[model samples]
Target chain A: MRVALADDGALFRDGLVMLLEAAGHEVVGCTADGDTLVELLATEPADVAVLDIRMPPEPDGGLSTAERLRADHPELGLLFLSHYAETHYLIRVLNIGTQAIGYRLKEKVGSVEVLSDTLTRIRDGEIVIEPVLAQRLVDRPSSNRRDMLATLSDRELDVLRLMSEGRSNAGIASLLFVAAKSIEKHISSIFMKLGLPSDAAEQHRRVLAVLTFLRSVQDSG
Target chain B: MTLDTYDATGSARRRADEHWSRRRDLERQLHDGPALRIAALTLRLGLLAQKARHDVGGLPHDIEELQYQLHLIQQELRAVADRIYPPLLHEAGLGPALRELASSASVRVDAGGGRFDPAVEGVVYFVIVGVLAALPPATRTVDVVIRRDADGLALDLGDVDTGQIGAVRDRVRWVDGVAEVGDGLIGTIRVRIPCE
Candidate 1:
């Protein structure tokens, strides 16, 4: 797969290039920060773009860049890497679309094997979130929200959990050993029980379910 | 003024919390983004070193030195990140954040409270941190109380040194709250912030 990366640190970016190239993936493009990354996409296209959430100096460097990339090239994949396990960022990126996106903590991305696997997953149209992120979302205080989340049947909740992790309908089906159509039915029921607007986009509704169940309790602070 | 004597509704309190929340959010972003990149780099370097050691011949001297340098960089970066904003500040609230601050301070400190508005909590944390940072090395035994009240929340820090009160007063003023600072070495500071 052709992969492009953007990070302000020269050493880290150089290491990533070596790591990706060593793993036999084509390093189609590289840029120092998100703005150049967006520009790189116009001419030197690649299958996916690995972005650092906060580039040097600018606090939220990659956020708008990814938003623009998603808007401009719907088929292009995105995988976000950051140091902290903050869910608000995850929600914003997931709301972009469930297709071809991945997020992992910088510290947790251990080896070329893991990064390559994630890229391959995204390339195959899966949402990839690091497990720590899922744990953080679960740990977020949901004092008033427990009942609503508890309404999901165990099997339904399993489907919602995988959906939140960026799994496709077919992917969830295979994981649960169910049919894709039943997974769709489970999702429709999840949405119906949550009282989401019927006309909302399917992707938006999926994100909404995840966001509702594991909404960042820290949004207040 | 006693907590109940003054009117407690003020727009600045809301605005202050918004500002502080944004500040904390920015700090967290730095912690998660750049801080983690260095960590990932360290891991990758370790992986490379492990490969050079086992799969290949003995580890290359150059790889060994590079690994040591990266380890130092990661540690220094982590320290810088923690000082920029301790994760406890956002996670555990003002009481824990302050305790973390006072961990190394020369003076003895006591602090506790119920949760309040994030902005109110932030002001309390930062003000106390600033105050403790300026306390005389000879100073000892400060007391702090933070609790929710009918109107909003009250924070009182006693036995404060006079020199640091200016910064504390400025922060209180920004929030449209009042800070009562005593005149002598054994001074007291009390603040009542509206819940707005």
Candidate 2:
């Protein structure tokens, strides 16, 4: 997949480039600022845009950029990367009704295989979210929420709850006392049972789901 | 024809009044626009020149970090240079250069130093000449001592007017160095340059 990776941190940007390229994915463009990222997207089309939620010029919300891109170019697959696992951001992305949109925590970017798989899934029309963020929604103790969890297995629910808190697979493994390999299997099952799209870009759906769940919780509170 | 001649005077008076009003407008513009611009430009240029002197004048000390003592010496040098042989000191080397400064001021200077780098010699020379120029017209004499030790070069500037000691000390502190004011109102500025 041709990917456009945008992040303000110089070290992280370079690392992502190396990781993506090593995974046999061609990175079309990389930028340190939101304005430059928008410009790059116009000139260079990519299969998916992997963007940081907070970029230069303003360190806070990247919702404006995301909103602009969704309005102008609906076909462009968008993935928002963030350090924080706030659920409101996920709701905003999903509300756009874009099938390939994704949200992934930055910490989960350690392995190239997982990152490439996620990117590929998003390009294939999947709505991906990180596993830990998904677990937060499943774990929320509410009659209305329990109905949502009824379709997902107990293991999938567990993963979703952890995913909500922005924990990576390694983090979930340690918490569950299960092997990291088992965590991956459980995450796949969660996606399968949730009727979530399993496009290669599904990693973003995990983040989006958790973000949406968090927003719902905040709104209710 | 007689009526027309009478009206000519009235017409001439109105024309004159219009001319005077136009002249006043031009004068106001000159006062508020170009003249103010020129003044602002002059102040900016003056600050630039002062900053340039502060930077370029200390080139010879070659010390990594300029101490307060060295800065004071440079400030005094600028004040003195502004008064006498200003451009020459910047253009020429220090030995005969400072002599020119002292001679112009009618001050007696006894200066001797072994072969030193041009920069070190320039700073020492400027400080000596500067302190002499700073002295009040009533004060008759000033002394300058320059020495090279194992640690670095030390310049002892003595006999600066007591009243200016505070000003001199403040200037020295600006450069991250020290100054000592003695009981005799002797303003001693000691600048030590580490041997490179």
Candidate 3:
């Protein structure tokens, strides 16, 4: 596959480009911003274009560019990489009039095989979603407000509902009458079920999950 | 007759003195309120402008991702300007201004029949942008819910990413507001700003 990589992060974009090239994919162009990516696409068309969801201008600026590309250049396969599993981006990806699209969390590119497989799938006309994101689609609770409480496991769901209400570990501990340490253990378990790593970015991922769940519920309603 | 005349004259002088004091007090309040408001507005705008400039320079340079971040900054700046002085709020009202701000993100906004006093709208706008500006690099989408009820204006900002919830909370608190961060992979921020 001839790939064009776009990401404002030099380190990340460089690493990804190297990975793709090592996997036998040809990288035709590299850009630090979306405008450059657009220009590259217009002039030097590639079979696939991999982009970071957020980049220069600001961290949240790349989504519109992605939409524009999907509209203008339907033949080019689109893939989005981000630090977070943003549902908004996912929905946008799903709405794009092509099936050759993919969204993956940056951390999930831990192996060359996974990245190459995703690129190939996108190039072959499959909507590739990261495993973590796929889990979200399966685990999303039903939107029936009455059944919403029942859709989650007692512990895993409690953590999620509190999370949606914007409670911290300490806050949840106080609310649930448990130790903060115990709350931490429950959260780790939740992360495992959700296919997310429990690390410094865990809280951010949890927020992303809750937002996805909420948005799904909102959409269903 | 002489005694009656003296009492009437004394009473009249006392009433005149009381009326003069009341007038002076009212005049002081009238001058103070607007002067203080103007000073506060000026200071707030200055601080916001400085912060905006700092944020622009601090923007990351992952060129592939530049367009996304650039769009976010543009949306934020517009929100900041509308907040500082809502030409829209003054003309079309709160709903129109918020709708305009929300349109930039391509996200659906449900305002819930909330109305903003012009001043409240200004504060809400700045607070929203300031919180957004403070967001760490990982956050993707920001869901802003501005509600005006018995407690004034409450802003519920839910970020699509939560990695920097602690930093976001600290920054929000520094602005003299309360931030509630939910535990999960994604983060939601609930800020309550009193109308007063």
Sort candidate 2 into its docking category: incorrect
Winner by TM-score between candidate 3 and candidate 1: 1
| Predicted model with the maximum DockQ | 1
Q: B1-196 in candidate 1: lDDT tens per residue?
A: 7677755645555577678777777776765566655665665774685466544445655665665565456556655655555555666566655543433443333344566666766776778778877776634656667777787768777777766767887887766667777678667888877663
Model 3 lDDT tens row, A86-160: 344565556663367777766454344556777876777656666555544435432333244344477766666
Misplaced by over 4 Å in model 3 are A57-59, A142-215, B1-145, B148-152, B155-196
True contacts kept of each: 0.17, 0.00, 0.00
Q: Which candidate gets the maximum TM-score versus the true structure?
A: 1
1 or 2, greater by DockQ: 1
What is the DockQ score, from 0 to 1, of model 3? 0.03
For all candidates, state DockQ relative to the true structure.
0.12, 0.01, 0.03
Q: Using alpha carbons, what is the TM-score of model 1?
A: 0.57
- Candidate 1 lDDT over A1-221, as tens digits, reads 89988987676677777777767789989988888888888888789999887774265677778888999888899998766455556666777766798887665554566677889889888778877566445433333444566676878777877877777799889999988999999999999877788899887788777776554233212
Ranking by DockQ, best first?
A: 1, 3, 2
Q: Could you give candidate 3's per-residue lDDT for residues B137-158 as a string of tens digits?
A: 4234466666676866566666
- What would the TM-scores of all predictions be? 0.57, 0.39, 0.43
Q: Give every collision pair in model 1.
A: A83-B32, A84-B32
Model 1 segments more than 4 A misplaced: A153-159, A168-205, A214-221, B1-38, B42-196
